[model samples]
Target: MCRGLDSLPITCLERAKELRALFGSFLQKSDHNLKKSEKLKLSDVKELLQWKESFDHLLSSQNGLCLFRAFLVSEFSEENIAFYLACEDYRATKASKLAPKAEKIYKEFIDSDAPREVNLDYATKAVTKENMEQPSQSCFDEAQAKIYILMEKDCYPRFLKSSMYLELTRKTRTG
Candidate 1:
C-alpha cells in the first residue's frame, strides 16, 4: 500500500511533464501563425484606417487581402476568395491553356448550377459564357470586377465592423 502511494506521485509528475510539453508546442505554433499574420505593411494599415479609402486600394496590399480573406471566411463567403483566386490564376494562364482553364473557371464559379457559383447576375453570366467560346486574357474581366466591387461595397464594411477586425486593430495599435 505504501509503495502504491509513492508511485502515484511519480506517475502524476510524468503526466504533468507530458502535458506541459504538449501545451508548449501548441503555443509555439500559435505564436508562429500570429507572427505570420502580423506582417501587414504600415501603408496598408494607413489605408485601412482611412474610412474614405477605396476597398480596392485596401485589397492591393497582401496583408489587407489576407485579413479580408479571413473575414470573408468567417462570414461563410469563402467562395468569394475562391472566385477571386480563380480569376487571378486565370489572368496568368498561357494561351495554350486558356480555353480549358476558362471553361473550368466558368463551370466552377459562373455556371448557374455550379456547386460554388458566385452571385453574378444573369447578364454577366451570359457574357462570361459567350467569352468562353473564345477565351482570352480578358475573358473573366467583367465578372471578376463585379465580384470585386461586391466585396468592396458589401463585405468590406461589414469586415471593418466585425469583432475580429476590431480586436486585430486593437492588437495592432498596442503592439
Candidate 2:
C-alpha cells in the first residue's frame, strides 16, 4: 500500500497497463455472466492467496500496481472485459488449451539460452524497447491466446478459483 499518484512513475504506468490488459483478458474470458456485487474474497483461500501474493510480489517497484488496482481492480475494462473472461473459460473447459503452445515454445527455446523456465514468462514481459515503448493489442491477444492454450488442463479447484475470480472481476467492475 502506497496510495496516491505521487509515488507512481511514468514507466510503471506503462507496465501497469500491460498487467491490466493481462488481468482484463483473464476476466474477459469467463464463460459465466457475473455481476460486480458477487462476493469473492480471496483472503481465506490459501492457494489463491498464494497466487495473489505472488502476483502482488511481482510488482514491488514504485507504484507497480497502482493502475491495475485503479483500473482492473475497480471496474472491468468495459470493452475487452469479455476477452479477459476467456482465460478461465478455456482453462476450465478445454483440457489441453495451454499445453501445446507451451510445449512448442519450450521446445523452441529449450536449446537456446532463455532466461525463464517457460515461454509465457518470456512472452509476458516483452523485452525489446520497441515493445516497451508502445502497447500492442496484438501482443495482448497473442499472449492471452497462448496462455489459454497452456492452462486448459488445470485442475477443477484451480478452475473454480478462476471462476471465482471472474465473479470478482464483475464485482470489481460494478462495485
Q: Rate the local accuracy (lDDT) of all candidates.
A: 0.68, 0.37
Across residues 1-175, which tens digit of lDDT does each residue of candidate 2 receive?
Answer: 2223333355755665654454445445443554443224222122223434444331232232343333432332211212333333434534334444333333332223432222345545454213323333232345555444443332212433444344544543443
CA displacement after TM-score superposition, residue 171 of candidate 2 (Å): 8.0
**lDDT (tens digit, per residue) of candidate 1 on 41-121:** 444346545532667665676445655665565576757766887899989989999999998989878897776778999
Scored by lDDT, the top model is 1
**Off by more than 4 A, model 1:** 1-52, 172-175
Poorest lDDT segment (10 consecutive residues) of candidate 1 = 1-10
RMSD of each: 14.8, 16.3
lDDT of 1 at 92: 94
Give per-model TM-scores: 0.68, 0.21
